[model samples]
Target chain A: MSAVLTKDIVKTFADVNAVDGISLAVPDGEFMVLLGPSGCGKTTFLRIICGLERQTTGDILIGGTVVNDIPPRARGVAMMFQSYGLYPHYKIRDNIAFPLRTQRVARAEIENKVEWASNLLGIGHLLDRRPRQLSGGERQRVALARALVREPTVLLLDEPLSNLDAKLRASARNEIKQFQQRVGTTTIYVTHDQVEAMGMGDRIAVIDHGRVRQVGTPTAIYDDPADRFVATFVGTPPMNLVAWNGGHLGFRPENFLPRELIDDSAVTEFSFRVDRSEYLGSERIVYGVLEGLESVQEITAKLPPAHVDQESIRPGEWHAFAVRNSALCYFDKDGKRAIRH
Target chain B: MPRPLAAAIREVSFYSAVLFFVVIAAFPFYWMVITAFKTNSDLYTLTNIPFWFNEAPTLAHIKYLFTQTLFARWLLNSLIIGVCVVAITLVTALPAGYSLARMTGRSGETLGIGIFMTYLVPPTLLFLPLSRVISMLGLQDSMWSLVLVYPTFTIPFCTWLLMGFFKAVPREIEEAAVVDGCSILGAFIKMVLPVSVPAILTVVIFTFTLTLQEFVYALTFISSSAQKTITLGVATDLVRGDIYFWGELMAGALIAAIPVAIAYNLFLDRFIAGITGGAVK
Candidate 1:
């Protein structure tokens, strides 16, 4: 059975459709991410599945049972908020034990569960401390412990790492994924950061303007974006898109290289002026205007530093770059990817 | 050398002004205590001998107030009314405020504003109409009238204050509680209320003090001498027709003011915090 299935979920606020009739099924033990920008209704969708919000017209099934009308407590799901909502008045131990206490578990069982969750999160020593007394990372761990202590059927995390600093966000993302894997819980994470969605999710659902644009494994979405929005939103320095007569050509900066690396018969070669080059340690990014094209159109190519260094390339100079035909992506005028021979 | 001299002069002038203001405000209270102990002749003379106590200080007025008058009974009546008003204000205002904070959309916002507007309407206008209502209810000339009327003013203001307090709680904290198996009401009681103690204390102190010192409604609604509160009882009975019992009156005012002053001082930090916490985002 599917761990969770949301069928034709529709939520409307006044005249605006916040979630416009979407559907998806999350397999058990898979980490699925709803990736979108703010105001895209990804968080609203997560809330609806968690039962914190009600869908205007839809059905939700969790663990093979319909839970459309179930209250949040009876939904058998736990949510971790982005703000790390630790109860300020309670010590960490009590905060983690809140879910068990609410279920009226025996006192000894509550203590044991709280202790086990705390120790797993490496917060055993901080159990006696209040949330205000702990650091940002520590408070996040407490929130995670609280959510995990219940051992719910599904775990919902809403932008849980957005509040952390950049350095901490990377480490926290890895730790959260590792923890989810160890617990083997079916997880649904919502985030606006596509990098986070790509790095953490087993499959990503790209949403925009309250509709799902594409849903696929990270590699599929990266290499074969269904539309222009997914192409531009998924990658860093995103895919370079240029208008063609009847279609569009899409390629990544790294795919473009010095002409010598390409087999002459199997490559498409283009000449461009080297406007500038940025040394990014492992590779150099070359930015230039395509030769014989409109001045407004600029192309970026990522090449190994040795090639650019050997050629003595500098700004305001011209160079020839090429790519294998297999590496190029074609999108029709409607922004949907078109098959290329 | 010139700058140093100018700075020193500025510092001295500032200190002098502060001292002058403190003395000016405190002199009347000081004179009241001095006169309360003086013989009736000393009071009539109105001498400017401010620093010295009466030549033959006596407690005759204090003795008279306790023994011959219903001063003690009136004091008891005021305490009972104040405590009851405080309790009622808290019970009604806390939940109303939480609802406004949590449930406010456009309509709730309009209703909250409307409730606050009622609070801002001057009490002078309200008391006249309220007296008729009080009499119709057969509460006039009784402590019950004051108890009922006090909450009308106090409840609106306290609810407004607590709405701000409740809004300051992060929504995520409450949502976390809900996910932890708490019902909405359970989350409020278990999570929201405990963090809001400082704001609640401010509301309690403010409602109690305002009810204790209110004069117009109490004086207008309650006509019977037997049922008078401390404010009306002290102001009316202590002073006779064309003869102000200056010493006895001052003594009575000072005695009545002590409890509220002490309460304010004890919860001063919370009062400041609650009032200002709403001003921040």
Candidate 2:
């Protein structure tokens, strides 16, 4: 069953259409991520689902019930914020128990749940400490614990890991996924980081300009993007987009191979001048300007260290390269993916 | 070495300037305390004696002020009015300020600004017409008149003060509460209020002090000996027929300033936190 659903949700702020009539469904126990650039209404859509924000005109159903006019508290949902939003004055135990206490659960039950949550998050020893005393990662765990302790039907996380440093973000992301899986709760995660969406989500909804560009499993979205935006947005160093004749050809840098590896009679082959190369430990990223293109089209190719001699390939030297047929993505004039004929 | 000496001289000059300003600000209060304990003869002599307590200090003025005049009654009246005004101001201001802070859209912002602007309208201009309104309610020459009138200034000022404070609280914290099954009111009470204790305490102190020291309204509205507040009673009785009781008047002034001074000294951190927190953000 669809645990949470929105149909044609529209939200406008003054002259700006912040959420412009978007629709989607989050199935039971699914980790759905709304991935987009900042201000693309991903967070707005999450807020609408959590009932923190009111949609201008839409139907929001949680667990198959229309909840448009329902207040957030009655919606049976909990949100973990990007800032953690742990009550600075409350100890970790009270913070986790807040929702249960508000619901008038028995005191023993509240204590048991708080303990369970703290243990789950590896914060059992820190329950007596206030949020101010905890480090950023600890506070984040406490926030997650607070939300999970409620055991709501759905959990909404709004860029919850964005505040952490780079190294912490990576480990924290895995921990968040692990926690969500163990809880088996329907989760809607919002982030602009495509890597996070790819790593954390069961299904990724790529959004831009207040609209959903595509929604599919992370693998499908990455391998067969619905549009040029999703294609470039999902990859490391982004997909290399080069205008070819009347259409645009997209391919990942890792897919490009040296000419010696490809058959001479290959169907797609291009000659380019090597402009620059960056050595990223295990692989060399060679940036080249395509020879026969009208625009200054630069294509980057990731070459394994074994295949090419770094000393031989100097800048301003022309080279021939070929892309694997399965790796090439073609986009028509409107920037939409053209179905392969 | 020579450069260090010049720097030392500059530092000494800076400290001297600060000391001069501190003495200027504090000298009047110091003199008030000393004069309060002085005999009538010592006050009349007006000597520039710095440290020595030459003559035996008398508590006659303090005794006379307390017993011979309606000073105690006026003090009680002021205390009653101040406390009531503070309580009323806080009750009205907190919720209203929270609403202004959390509610989105242009209307909420406009309304918040509108309420604050009402505070800026000069009280001196409004009090004359407000006096007529007070008399119509038959609160003239009564402590109740001062109680009712003081809130007109206190509520708006405090609401504005607290609106800034409430705005400083992160919206995410409130949202987290809401999602945790808290109604808007619950979120306010459980989350916003606790974090905002310092700001609220500062507001209480400010309102209490303002209402306690208010002169124009208290002087204008109340006329009876029993009904007059501290400021009115002291000014009227001590300066009878242009023969000022400087010694006794200073004594009364010193006594009256004690409560607020004590309150401030106790909660200095909260006051600084509220003003700086509210102002900067």
Candidate 3:
């Protein structure tokens, strides 16, 4: 059975649907990431799943049991907040032990579980110190340990790495992913950063404006986005859309390389004008408009640095660029993906 | 002027301003201390230097305050009222403030403002109706009347103060606790209240000191000398028409002020920022 499942959850705040009907199932031991931009209801959806927030309509099930009327503590879920939310006054030991103590677990077993959790997170030495005394990364580990101490049925994390520095975020991401895998706990992670979602998620649920736009494996979500929003929202220098046959033709920047780089027999060609070029060490991004669609739309082509020397593409000049026939993504006027006509 | 000399002049003027304010603020305490210790003869003599004692200092006034009057009973009454009122204020205000702080939209702000507005109605105006209520409760001339009436002011202001504080306490902490096997009230008591020690201390000291020094309501509600609070007793019982017992009055004021001073010093270090640090960004 799926460890956690929501059936058409809708949470309305002040007549505004903060979490509009979102139904998702997180299978046992799967890392499901809810990915979106800020204020996109991803966190709200996670909160609903955790029982921190009640859906205005619909039922929540944990381990196949309906938990609509159950409180957060009884729902067998644990959450790590965006801020890490370690109890500021408690020592790390007590913070990790708090959940078990609340459940009135046996004293010796609480100690053993606390030790197991601290050991799992490798925070055994910092047990006596308080939360404020720890660094940001340490605090994140402590929060993770506290969430994992009880061995919950589902683990919900809401942007838990956002408070760390850029350098720390990468390693913290690795730590949490590896830690989650080691424990094999069903996890639902929320984040706006595509890098984290793509790198760590077993499956990514792309959400926007209180609705899930797409739910697929990261590779599928990136390579075969279900809609224009997912296609445009997931990649850096996002997918370029130009007016095509009264609809939109979408192609990733990396796929729209110079014609010289295309080895495929089937290709669609465009006369690309390079207005600006940025050489970002590993790749070159060329920004320009296509010949016929110049005034209406701008397109981008990301070329691998090895394939194109920086001196080759000059600004304010025209060059031939093509996307393989297989790489083109057609979308209807409503931003839904459509098969090529 | 040369740069060094200009800097020197600025430095001198800054210290001079600081010294000026310090002396102005401390002058009353200095006067109280000296008068409390001065002998009756030195105080009554016109030629004696007012700032310092001409005769040997004595504890005679403090002795008189304790033995010759209901000063000890007044102290006990003030302590009881302060404790009771602080308890009531915390019990009422903490939950009220936490809920108000967490309440969504403009309603929390509106309700908080409504509660604080009651605090702005001065006790001078409030005492008339309050006195009627005190009499109706049959608590007139009892220190319990002051205890009952004090939270009417304290809870409102403290609730407003604590609402601002609890609002600053990140909602995520309490939410985390709730998810980690706690009820909403448990989260508040475990997660919210621990980090809010500084704010709670501020409320305790504010309520206690306000109760200790309050006179108007104490006077209106409790007419008996034995039931008078420290402030009311010090002022009224130490005065006989135009003849004021200045020594006993100063002694009483000095003694009543000590606990608040100690409380401030005791909790001032806790009014720090790092309590919630490392928990959030």
Listed for each candidate, the true contacts retained, as a fraction, are 0.84, 0.89, 0.87
* Model 1 alpha-carbon miss at residue B75, Å: 1.7
Candidate 2, which CAPRI tier?
high
How do the residues B11-97 of candidate 3 rate in per-residue lDDT, one tens digit apiece? 999999999999999999999999999999999999988999899999999999999999999999899989999999999999999
Mark the 10 consecutive residues where model 1 chain A has the least summed lDDT: A289-298
Which lDDT tens digits does candidate 2 get at residues B1-281?
Answer: 69999999999999999999999999999888888888777777757474445678889899999889999998998889888998899899999888777675567778878888888887788889999999999998899998898888888778878888998998888888888888888888989999999899999999988887788888789888899888888888789897889778989999999988999999999899987776787
For A130-248, candidate 3 gives per-residue lDDT tens digits of 99999999999999999999999999999998999999999999989998899999999999999999999999999999999999999999989989899889999899998777778
User: What local lDDT score does residue B27 receive in model 2, on the 0 to 100 scale?
Assistant: 93
Interface RMSD for each of the candidates: 0.6, 0.8, 0.8
Tens digit of lDDT per residue, candidate 1, span B88-118?
9999999999999888666766787789999
DockQ of 2: 0.85
TM value for model 2:
0.96
Cα displacement (angstroms), candidate 1, residue B61, comes to 3.2
Shift of residue A149 alpha carbon in model 2, Å: 0.6
Candidate 3 clashes between residue pairs 3 or more apart in a chain or in different chains: none
For candidate 1, give the lDDT of residue A199.
Answer: 93
- Evaluated against the true structure, the overall lDDT of model 3 is 0.90
Whole-model Cα lDDT of every candidate shown, in order? 0.87, 0.87, 0.90
